[model samples]
Structure formats: C-alpha cells, structure tokens
Target: MVVPEHRVFDPASSDDRSIYDRLVELGGVHVFDTTATQLHSLRALLPTPPEDVLGEEVRWVHYPWRRSLVRVLGPRGFRLLRLDRNRNKITAAEQDDMARLCVGVVGLSVGHAVAHTLAIEGLCGELRLADFDDLDLSNLNRVPASLFDLDINKTVVAARRIAELDPYMSVVPYPDGLVESTFESFMDGLDIVIDECDSLDTKLVLREHARRRGIPVVMETSDGGILDVERFDLEPERPLLHGLLGDLDASALKNITPEQKAPLAARILDPSKLTPRMLASVPEIGRTLSTWPQLGSDVALGGASVAAVVRAFGIGTPPPSGRIRINLDAHLAAISEVEPTASGESISPANQPR
Candidate 1:
C-alpha cells in the first residue's frame, strides 16, 4: 500500500526546524500562506470580540505526495474559516457535530466522489476507504484521476486526494479490500457506511454487518441516480437490500467471479427502472461494452445526493429507509412537457421559450 505522508510544523518550535529545513532543501516545494484571509473570515464569524491581543499561531502542513507545503491557522481557526460558508445552512453547532463522525466507504469508484464531497464539506472527522483494485486507464472516463495516477491502488488515490483537500481529516485506506477476517476491524467505530463496490456478495456482507451493529448504510447506483438508504440503525431488522435478494445468504455468493456479478447487481438496481441507455448497455457489459456504462455526470450527481443523505443523518434528521431516484433524464423529459402555468394560466406555443 502506498500510504499518504503528511506532517504539520509549528514554526515557533525549534524542535521542528531541522526537518522543516530539510524539506525546504529538497526543493520543488509549493508554499501557500493564507492566514491573512483566514483571520479576516474567522473574526467576522465569531459571536463576540476575541482577546485584544489575538496572537496568530500559524501551522505549516507538508504533503509529500504532492510536494506542497501550505500555511494556515491552527485547527480551531482553520476549521472555522474553511467551513464558514456552510453557516446557517449547517450551523456552527451542526458542523461541530458532523466533525465527530467516522464514515467508512467501500468501493473507490463512486466512493471517490462521496469521500471527496464529505471531505470538502467537512461532513466527517475520519474516513475509511476500502478497495483492492488499482486505477486503470478506462476508469478515467468517470473517475476523477489522471494518467499519472495509473496503477495506484484506488484506496490510495482517494486517500491522497482527501489529504490534499483537508490535511486535518483522518483517512484510513484499506488497499487489500474487505474480507471476512478484516471485516471486524473495518466496521469498528464506523458511524455510517457507504457501499459503492461492484461485487454483489460484498454488498450483502457489508449490509449484514452494518445491520448487526445498527449502523445506517447508504448506496448510490450511478444508473438513473438510484440512491438506497437502509436505516438499520432505526430498523435493525430491516431486510438486506430491502429484501431484493430473497433471503440469499452472502456466504453462498462468496468468491463469486466478476462474470456472475452482473445479473445480481441488476437485481439490486432493478433493470426496468434503469434509463434506456443504461438498460441497453447492461446486456453488453461482456460483449460490446467494457463494463456497465457510467457517466461522469451521473457519478457527480450521485456524489452530491449521497452527501446530502449523509448530512441529513449527521444532523439527526435521517431520511426513511427506501430506494429513491433522482434521475436527471426523467426530470428533463418532464420539462419538455406542456404543464399548466402557475396561476392556472397556459402559455401559447409561440410564447414558450425556445
């Protein structure tokens, strides 16, 4: 596993000067100092006036993967400034509450987007990512990765990106992927689990463990923007995948090959509800298509939708357990229809906007 390396340096400490000097000498380092802007925002967001002598304690964070060093305020001030814009929408108290959550995500493809949104929004304090596969060139179409990231483990790639976005966030990478032996360690202390992996068997196993622990599970299938929120936390006895598999034991599907996963995956993501393109593409996965087609647009929407559900869960207003769709194509199709105008009025055909 290629773990991400980072360190915080307090310039006032003589003990940290030697290593900081070495990093400077290594060269090719990009330095960023935004404490001035941060302080400006921090003071504005505070309820009451702070101390007369507001001494600024700046910290420098070094990311070896990107070879960049950034300067910012201390943790409290940094978080306040970084997430200041989320105020009112996600009040200061709510933001603080979210920071205490530990979210685990399996399957780094769509999981990558979920983790990115969670990190960007400061939705969780710690994130655990699991995926055994490495980045392939074909994944670039939907995955936000480049040629330089080729061959890197998916978990490592997502973790490094999250670290770069928020060094304050704690990211644990499971490059070896999830298995029966490692399941206990992965489930330990997870407040919520997001399933994005492709394996039908792995999906069942994740839900089973989460149900036993009474932790909610969130899943978003990029097809038709299908989002499944199973609130096992509230309904501990809720059937796995909403009982779509009909009492199918996860153990029976263990070690199943990729060829066998397509049909099962379709069952979870009902084929009849899929978009015409996706429904058509499903049958050609091993034939005409490389794999089930996934658009970057749909994946991006899935990320935002998943983050919305997680935020609701974080704020103590969890949505009911059910499969919901936020299909853009369907919405667009509705827009093309001629519905009655607001005020019981109807626009003439010639008056309609082109």
Candidate 2:
C-alpha cells in the first residue's frame, strides 16, 4: 500500500460532539439504524452527520472505528473501493509492475505535456524532470505554464505542478539540462528515459548514454510528428543510431563544417521525397539557421500519443522501435523499422528528416 505523506483526516473537536449526539440534537435518529452494529457502522461512516440533526442526546460512540468505517462505506469510499472493483479488469501482476516504474523526462517544453498525461494516468511511481530554460512569453502558446510562470525555470514549475497533481509521485527536478557531468547522476536508478530536448547534441548524448547503460528510451520529435522508441535492452549488434547516422563517431562527424553538414543532413533526410508543404517551411527555417520546424498542434498530439506508448510499454505491451511518424496533414502514420546493412551502413528512408 502506498502511503501518502500527508493524509487528510480530521478528528472531532471539543466544540463538535459525536455523530449520534448531533443526530439526536436535530429531533431523533430518523434515518439511522436501530441495531447496535448498524448504528456503529453508520456513526463510523458519517462525515459531519450528513448536514442534518434530529435531537439532542449525547450517546456513547465508538471513536476508533469511525475513520475505518467511513473509508470502507462512506460516499467518498469509492477512493478506496475502486481499487478492488476494477481488479478483474486489470491484471494483478501488471498493476504491481506499473507501481514500480521510474521514468526521467529531459526538457520540460513538450515534456510538460508528457508529464501532465503521465501524472494524470498514474503511470509512474516517480518522475524526474530536467531543463535549464526559463518560461518565456512565447512558451504560453504550447507549454503548460502561463504568464504567472514567465520568469520561472521550466523544471521548477513542472516539479511543483507534478507534486500538486499527485502528492504520492516522487518528482526530482534538475534545473540544468543533462550534460556529460550530470548524466550519470540523472540516469541513476531510472527504469526508462524520455528525451524531449530540442538539441541534436543532447539527443545524441542521451542515446549513447542509454545504450551504454542498457536502458530503453522513448523520444518525441514534434517537429516531424515523429516518436522514436529505442530499445537498447535488446542489444542490437551494431552501434546506436546505426540506421540514422551510420557508424561514424560524434568527433569524426562534428569535424564536418556547417556547409558539409547541410548536404549530409539533406542526403540523410532526402528532402526530394518530401511533399511541397513539408518543404515550404524548410526555406524559411533555412534562412534562420535550419532549426527544425514544428506545427503547434503536433505538440499536443505527440505528447498524448507518446504518453500512451509509454504506458503501454510500462504495462508490458510490445512496441516497435525506430521512427513512428504521424503525418497529420496527410492523415497518415507509418512505422519504419530498419536494420544495419551487411556492411554496417544505415538504411536511409526517402521521407525521414535528418
């Protein structure tokens, strides 16, 4: 049983008498049982005597069983009763498994959306949130924060909100983004990591770290309507990102200048296969340093969809790895699963973005 640190329970004060006393104070016990056991149960279950009174007579009431009976039979008893009501519908083993999941989400921009869904779904026992960016006016359009949170860092805001939503949820906030120095501590004792950061460097680092640690990762790329779930637990013979960047190390890859990176990225992305609408944003984005283009609606869609995938994975449902693209424009979605070629070269898809 998970015990909440702060449970709401109010004991009767000197100003307040027992339920039977309050009931008799009205006139008589009009709606109460006559038998001792039933009366005891009724007295135990009443929260403030149902807002009515019958007479004024101080009766001997059992104080010990009051809270227990209320918990088991009162109007708000569903909080406790629902646990067993849905038992047959959910596997006992699966519920037990879900209660033990600990997931770390990096980047609180879209991650806030993911955390909101996960906290509401009661999917994780503990959530670790990381981000260094502060909330800006522009974030109001998409992030969970508002104008009130304008100056506050996202991780701090997200942690407080998560606590308010579910007090039992253990939330650890890292005000700094995960870098080489912070990676080990942040990744420690975590069952899974969800990459929601916008930095390609951070994504690459997280993927490498997860691969090294043999942890599974579910990353959401709202810009491309892509959700990538990588299962390092499977121990694929080739290195990580084999299907995306081939077998080149980060140092070797970074030595290529921006001019070279562009064509390489274009080749890897194969923009020739992109629809005109998809290509339209590229020129505008290219003028501004080639940051990825994201549709506003993709944030909500990707967050909710990826959260569902995470819950499914948590409950032991098998999900495919690699990129799962949901093209809202075309009302189409596809899963591309790739394996390294015989020569250990990555197989590039025509429509995938670099």
Candidate 3:
C-alpha cells in the first residue's frame, strides 16, 4: 500500500525535527541533489531577476520504498523544467491545464504502460490505478515490471514507479481490483477512465457507470493497435462499446465460462479487425498458448497512442467516439515484392503470436 502522507517531504516545512537531524536518524539513505541544475534551467526559462529565481525554495522528496531522498525545485519550478521540452508543441498553458485533470486506469497489464506514459508526459495531476492481481513472472513480456516485482500487487508496482519518476504526482493504488464496492469511489473525480482489464463483465460495468456519469472512456486492444473511445461526456446517450455487445449488461456476463467468453469477445472486438497473427492464435489458446498474445512493442505503441488521445481530451479537442486501428505493420510494409528466401526477406518465425 502507498502511504501518501510520507511520499514527499518538504525540508522547508516547519517540522519539529530539522531535516539534517532526520537524515542522521535515517542513516544509509541515498540522497540525490539536482537543485543547482534545476535552478539554472529555471533561470534560463524566466526573465525574472537572479535573486528572485534563486529565492525559490528547494524541497526534499523522500521515497520511503527505495530509502532515497531527492532534492528538487518546488512544484512550479520543477514542472517548468520537467516539461520544458513540450514547449510550443504543448504550450505551457496547455500543460498546466493538463495537470489539472484526474485520470483513472483499470487492469494494470496494458494499463501499466498507459499509466507510466501519462505520468512521463505530465498529462494528469492525479492517477487512480486499480488492479486486483499481483505481478506474475510471466507478465514480464509486456508488463513494465521486474523479477523483484514478482508477486507484488500490480497497482503498487505501477504507483511506486510513478512516484519515483514524479513525486509531485498523486497516485492512488487499489490492490483489490474493481468490484461493485469500490467502483463508485474509483470513478469519483476522474476526468477520464481507461479500461484495460481482462474481465468482460468489468468492462461492461465500467461503461455503464461512465455513461451515467457522462465520463469519457478509452480502451486499447494490444492487437492491431486498436483504440476504442466512448465520448460519454459529449454523447451520454451513445451505446456502450459502439453497440458491439448489443444490449448485453454486466449481469448476463457474470460467472461465464472461458468457452462462452470467446464468442462474446469476438463480437466485441470484431474478428475482421484482428491482426492475422492474432486471429490465428484464437484456436490455439488452450492447445498451445495459455492466453491471447500481446507483445511489448504493441503494448508500448498502445501506451503512446492512448497518451495522445488523453492529451487531446485535456486540451478540449477530443476525437469522436469510435474505434480506430493504428497498425504499424500495415503502415511500415515493404514497398517492393520479393521471391521466397530472397535477401532482406521480411517474413520471420517470430511473427507468430506469442
């Protein structure tokens, strides 16, 4: 569990114990100081006098999980330098507006990449992450985790990584994945919700709530870079999942067997849209593979794609509700045809679904 109170420490605060004394108490803790570089960058960005910029107080952020302390500029100066490269393209004003939004992500497999990208791009001020499962050893193929993270709750792993990257960002982790009990609070105050969970019932439930609340929902299928967006915020009357699972409610999906889930999933994610490799893997799931295949590259690409859509929503230029494929294979194909076994042959055995 992430103790939000102890996440970031401000040495400038009027604490009873001095920061130096506290550091001495917590011996062997690694301390990182980047205040000088941050101040220099701050000076270059602003026309304010050196004295004024120099007067900006430095804060010490403590990462209790890592037993490390980092010295950084205050929120204003830190954000300026952290997001400096987003200039003109994402203008400072746009970034500031983005920072005010709150985003929630469910199912931490693909959601892990989405959450990390959101934090790295400074797209949201707070992130609410919910995933019931722990990090499995086999999840490393696409999950942004490691051997040490094995067996740890996925939400905690993701939240800790985000905290290490930007202590200023608020991350709330729900170890127990979403259920009827926590769903309301999880959806509360969220400007956008990203569904990456594996449960078909949960997906239906998520949209039911989002539609009622008029909150937009985004989902990315690791196959074919399929991105699904439901602008419930703009069109409250819109059908869930673009009416793919016509009038099917979560209640009907409860306790469904694996055999029953396959056909419904196909209906939801049209079989015609599935990549050739993914379509082929469907029958072999129980025979050769444990589950559907997802590649790290595809997960990473989906992360970038989702971040772009979320950013558009933040800037109030969100695309219409629908599904779109950002298939890299189709876009980056060879221009000329070649005979079998020819040099520079594109076909490879690794192209099969993992």
TM-score of 1: 0.89
| lDDT, residue 203, candidate 1 | 89
What is candidate 2's CA lDDT for residue 77?
Answer: 29
Writing each residue's lDDT as its tens digit, candidate 2 over 1-354 gives: 111222222233443345444534665223322334533444454242342321122222222212211211222221122233335444546655766888899988889888777766656778888888889877776786767678877887776666544444577778777866788988888878888875555667777888888778887766456677788877644355545666656556544545455554544345774546556655554466554455557778777877777778767884866666666765544435555667887664644347
Reference-based lDDT, each prediction? 0.85, 0.62, 0.85
Clash pairs, candidate 2, are 24-55, 24-56, 25-55, 25-56, 26-53, 26-54, 26-55, 27-54, 27-55, 28-54
Q: State candidate 3's TM-score.
A: 0.89
Please provide, for model 3 over 132-250, each residue's C-alpha lDDT reduced to its tens digit, 9 standing for 90 to 100.
Answer: 99999899999988898899899999988887778889899988889878899899888999999989999999999999999999999988899999999999999988999998978
Task: For candidate 1, write residues 1-354 as lDDT tens digits.
Answer: 234578778888887777788888988999888878877777776563254323557788998777888887777677766787787899889899999999999999999999999999999999999999999998998889888899989998888888777777889899988987678989999999999998778989999899999999999999889999999999999999999899899888977754566778788888789788877777777777767888899888988999999899888898999989999888776664455677877775445778
TM-score, per-candidate, Cα-based: 0.89, 0.64, 0.89
